[model samples]
Target: MAQSFQFETSTERYRDEHFLPYFRNGVTRGPMTAETSDIDGLADRSRTPPTVAVVDAQSPGNVGTIARAMKNFGFDELLLVDPPALDPDGEAYGFAGHAREDILPNATEVSFDHLVENYHTIGCTAVTNEDDHSHVRFPYSTPSELPDRLATVEAPTALVFGRERVGLTNDELARIDEICSIPAAADYPVLNLGQAATITLYELRSLTLTDEETQLPDLERVRAPEPTIDRVYDQWAELLEELNHPVEKREKTMRMLRRVYGRADLTTGEAIALLGLLRRATERPAEQ
Candidate 1:
């Protein structure tokens, strides 16, 4: 049977004690919004290159705002991999202003793997330090380095982002070169996806100062290698069959592990380390 909604008998008292004053004072329940005035003069376009992609973006407004930001910062190619929803003529366009008409229609949509495959280099952003993020460059080097990197970077550089609710998945995390993160106050570290992308692009634009700065002389145009996930417990599949561990139990354990590691935003290096740990653990004989 379907569950039915339940009403509290003390609702009137609860509201009087709790919600009444807040409502009367014009306070409402919702997420905080960052306040800012006009951004026309402040938006910089020279920092970003022609190749950038946002993956699995969940919000329609976020998608449009990010596209608008890309246009503001002189970025051309925008890829959306299985986005949650999009509104071409909604608030996104309102924020986009002139760029909306051009970008919203032509923005490319592709499978996540296909987008990663096309990019010469791919990078991701994360908030926490996991094994994959052990090598963090303080002050965030991507912005400073992007101009030089761009001069020599080949077509299609993937900038993988995550869902608003949870960020990127482990499978997605494994597909990028490095996991980039903004060092914010510990009290409020996670940034909204659109804001993070916008800031990152702006920082990269800031670095495009001079001809000397823009030239990365020796960097070669090598294709970014694809990232892969090797489930260590695949071996456990056979062991579960042999030892008769319940299928549901094995699956639950695997899913929980995947979620934990996924949240860490594992980069290629960290994934390797984690896989090594798993390999060692799996090599031992099953408990009696």
Candidate 2:
């Protein structure tokens, strides 16, 4: 036999508080549109969409605007450090426009050091430091040059922005691996915090994920085996010895030779062909 249970208190109040109501299309309680994460598509990309880090921002509105810029350029991850007081109904969300739900609500608060330890930090600056000093450095690549440069990076990257008044400190700049400055004319230079972020994201738009529609290559050749490369090196060493090359310089020469071949990323067939040519060249000594 089963026992029946009854609740004396009303459960109707809980429906509107937590669950989606059966009939009402309430603005505040309505279904929120979410960004669909395309994991498979992201895997094909060489680099991830950079996490935007705002350091010591004085205004909440600026943060929201930055998040809006990120959504426009297909970036989602945001990191805030020493930010101003944020209010849901404040100008922060108002400035966010449509990206309010996408970026601001999900924004992460993290320490500046945490971003340094995890992702490759790209320091954003308007000032160009054209020096060879260890502490002071020029950008590794300009905005237009970033596509080619960042294409080879297969790791997580972050773009760090500083406060409105004074940009990133010298200590912060020194620790950064790379720095990027938006090229501006001398007559009317220096854009605002939001402008710089928007421009940077526009230039780096290629790194963002897209629809999984890119076709794969038909055939892919594997690299030459380690043994094949070692054998080729051994043969080259024997040829160098037979030529009476300077013994003192041979080791350095061999290392350079290794780098030359390594850059080729030779296949087994190509390695064998190169090894055969070395044998022929060694067999004939000056044709004397």
Candidate 3:
């Protein structure tokens, strides 16, 4: 006779790491939306690990896969910031299997800023160096840096990954405190969204201790939010437009500005400082 199985309630699913509970008659079965209560129950029991947010991703399959990877890697929080064409519980659960439906039912849908409000440290991964090196100047941080920095963390941290196509917008990246990238062949630099999430989580997972050990970076190292960068850039753009400066000159000046501040990787405080400076500098010319 075939064995019988039934989906667990929300409370039971949080602790269930594998899909066994959802199997019916010894067959793995996909849960319909009604089963989300089980996943919710699971979520209540489990403490969220650092969240991994995939922003503006286009493929639902990839989203499901990433959630699966997160569950495999022991990350509890899977956030989707502005994803396109997603049916959170329907299509994604098929890919997540039974182990990680918490991500499916309760996947936090938030703006980058909103996500950061709860997280103390946010790391963003980019495909290319992209003329900015605030979070990482070296190709990779030493193994020591990972555990040591992660150890001191007092609040929830988020590993923010970009979209499948363009990756994190400058605006999105700007909001993060640090940036990370997987070492890929130069010929083709981009990794799929799922691949990037898996690798990053893999690297981070290796650092956990029997006792939680997460390092906090010096406050100065944090980068300003992407919106702050947008505000600064917008100011610069407005100034150039107001001056009616030659396009080439404006472009050149903006490039130089990027080189200076982009390398410094301004923190939240630092960005505010710079914006204040711009406001002062661009104040209307005093009458002679």
Q: Give lDDT tens digits, candidate 1, residues 137-244.
A: 222334445556655442324556678767776566655554556557778877898887887777665433443444445543332223434443364354456667
Shift of residue 27 alpha carbon in model 3, Å? 36
What is the TM-score ranking, best to worst? Answer: 2, 3, 1
What are the per-model numbers of colliding residue pairs? Answer: 4, 0, 19
**Candidate 1 residue pairs in backbone clash:** 45-73, 47-204, 47-205, 119-156
Q: Name the lDDT value of residue 210 in candidate 2.
A: 46
Model-by-model lDDT, in order?
0.56, 0.73, 0.62
For residues 1-288, write the lDDT of model 3, one tens digit per residue.
Answer: 112223355544433532443342342223334444455543332222566788777888778888887766666666778876556466666677653447666676777666555454345454545454643322334222554565555334567777778787766655566656666777886778877777777677754322233343434267888899878887887777766779879888988887887888888887888788777766768558
Candidate 2 displacement at residue 185 in angstroms = 1.9
Q: How big is the positional error of residue 26 in model 3, measured in Å on the Cα after superposition?
A: 41
What is the Å distance of residue 189 in model 1 from its true position? 1.4
Better of 2 and 3 by TM-score: 2
Q: Write the per-residue lDDT of candidate 2 for residues 97-176, one digit (tens) a residue.
A: 88798799888787777767666678888776767554455744577777666666544567899998788988888777
Worst 10 residues of 3 by lDDT: 135-144
Residue pairs that clash (backbone atoms under 3 angstroms), model 2: none
Ranking of all predicted structures according to lDDT, beginning with the best and ending with the worst = 2, 3, 1
